[model samples]
Target: YGGIFTPTEAAGVGVMAMLAIAITQGALNWTQLKDSLLQTADTSAMIFAIILGSEVFDAFLARSQLPMKAAEWVSATGLPPFGVMALLMLFYILLGAVMDELAMILLTLPVFFPIVAALDFGLPPEETAIWFGILVLIVVGIGLTCPPIGLNVFVVSAIARDVPITAIYRGVLPFVAADIMRLALVTAFPVIALLLVRLLD
Candidate 1:
């Protein structure tokens, strides 16, 4: 509830609140809380390790100079910066069929992030970065509801296997399209993401 705290501190408070609730409800006793803390520590360590590993990998890639070279190649194509971003998103959507979202993020962030960051979208660099991250998250959520590797589809499949997979995919297509439309707005207009802040301020 503190307005001045950074997001990292906010998240820490949120987790503490959840831990407090679990203890109150007896869902997390002393022994269970200890286990949860251990698990959280393990996961957090692995996440940072991945971040550091990815950083080193990004450095290696930069040293090779291929992405910059590729960006130069792309810049020569005369496409708008956001146009290039749209094309990149389509590629991510297609890739979602083959790879899970987190895998795609982990593997490609090192490569694509630098490329996107280098482009000018009239916004500051950090705003562009946040916009692109939201775009990737939206695309991944779409992928989860889609076919070939749809996590939601699989979850629903067992509940309604008699309902043909094709039929389910057909049914969900409109919802997915709606999601795409929403994300398209977010991609094209950054204000939607910041609307709450604008209103509050």
Candidate 2:
């Protein structure tokens, strides 16, 4: 009946499938179902609250025109394109410390993309977009694992309450270091990201 399976529909289908399998195995009971539902509801509520808070904060930032002003200042610096990109990466790391990853990206992309597009990156617009996107994703992924507000770390800590949050943060440091190295490699060699795109083309 539907032309495409939306995410909500897909999630509903998955739940139904799991319920059917559990019933066939006689593994599910009313108590378990109730517990699962309660957990799901709690998780969903937390996620929604975070998203709502981020959206409101993002709107405030936008109204202040901070991103656009920052972009303008960067452009006026007379720095090379690579220098500009490096500065933006640093800014993203700081922003990610306080902002949700999705909210940060949606908030900054409009201001940053125009500056990037105007620079002489020597690649076609589409290729540049892909390369920039991968770089941004890498930086954001690092942010989600880094200190002070690593969203991934917090989520893990919440689930594994027996494990100290400090321990979890310590365990994640090596991976975060590796991510920084990978980000540097990709920034130096755009081909690392575009190789598959080129191959498919």
Candidate 3:
């Protein structure tokens, strides 16, 4: 039963539990409650806006057949399988810079997955998917923390208010370096990602 609840539902339940506790303790007055509700509404609105924008952008990409064209081009390239995968990783990094991570994954995977699936990566298709998914996750994480549009950096700056955005970007460099190192290792060694999956089986 617990497994049936989505993350959003779980978060909602948590919020309600906290609210109830606060009320019981008389720690949350009407003013505080109203302010909290207002902030929640604003945050919800921003999330919905992002979702709407992503859907619209995805629709546009689908209509243009960009993914299909890209896959075709990649297939036509004489590069070895690993070379092509490297190119795809680079593409993901660029895409992540401009798009939400979830949006980027949802928009690109339909096309990218098929291309990768056709490649001979010395692993089964399922394992290839797992490995590629992890690689993309790392690349996107790097994008989120990297400069020139690092979403997480801007978000932190926004929240901290006093911390300069440039300083935030500077601080994020070490984490991005670590992410790059991790990405390289995962790309070079599929077993790192497959170990847990194999254990489960």
Candidate 4:
């Protein structure tokens, strides 16, 4: 909250804090610690594999210039800014369904950011960027709860072994709907996204 730590540093601090609390609570036995370390290693390996795969996929897309061509086509259509934005949002949702959220952002931004920056969204350049980011984040979150490839659902399933995968997916449907509504609200009224940023400013 103080903004004194980078994300990686913050994660380290959080782990250390939790470790201290667990020790104080008499919950830091050697067996439990070994199990926790093993679990962490396993989880990290899975995440690393996913990230590596996404990186390879992103590289393939970049080499193919598919995103750039899509952007060029959209630009050629001369659609209204809102129409273009709608299409971009739809594309993001679809892409996010199969792609890692981080990779999705990095792969599309180079093409999409320039397209967005060129359009007049009735907001300052910085504000437009922020609003767009929030929207993408919401969409990515939706994708994360979507079925067949919802990474978050799978991750949760790993932790909650007794819960059926189908049940987990079912549980996330409401969240997906809510996120869609949020995306719509933010898209229709960009100021909703910008309000807090303005307050902070």
Q: Give RMSD to native, each candidate.
A: 8.0, 3.3, 3.0, 2.5
Give the candidate order by descending TM-score.
4, 2, 3, 1
Q: Flag regions of model 3 displaced more than 4 Å.
A: 1-4, 43-60, 153-158
lDDT (tens digit, per residue) of candidate 3 on 1-201? 378678989888888999999999999999999998997777666656655665676678768877678777887888988999988887777666656788778778888888888889999989999998888888988876777775666567655668897888889888888888888888988899999999997
Compute each candidate's TM-score over C-alphas: 0.59, 0.83, 0.80, 0.84
Rank the models by lDDT, top first: 2, 4, 3, 1
| Model 1 pairs in collision | none
User: Which structure is stronger by lDDT: 3 or 4?
Assistant: 4
Query: Relative to the unseen true structure, what is the C-alpha lDDT of residue 36 in candidate 4, on a scale of 0 to 100?
Result: 93
How many residue pairs clash (N, CA or C atoms closer than 3 angstroms) in each of the candidate models, in the order given? 0, 0, 0, 0
What lDDT score is found at residue 141 in candidate 4?
A: 83
Better of 1 and 2 by lDDT: 2
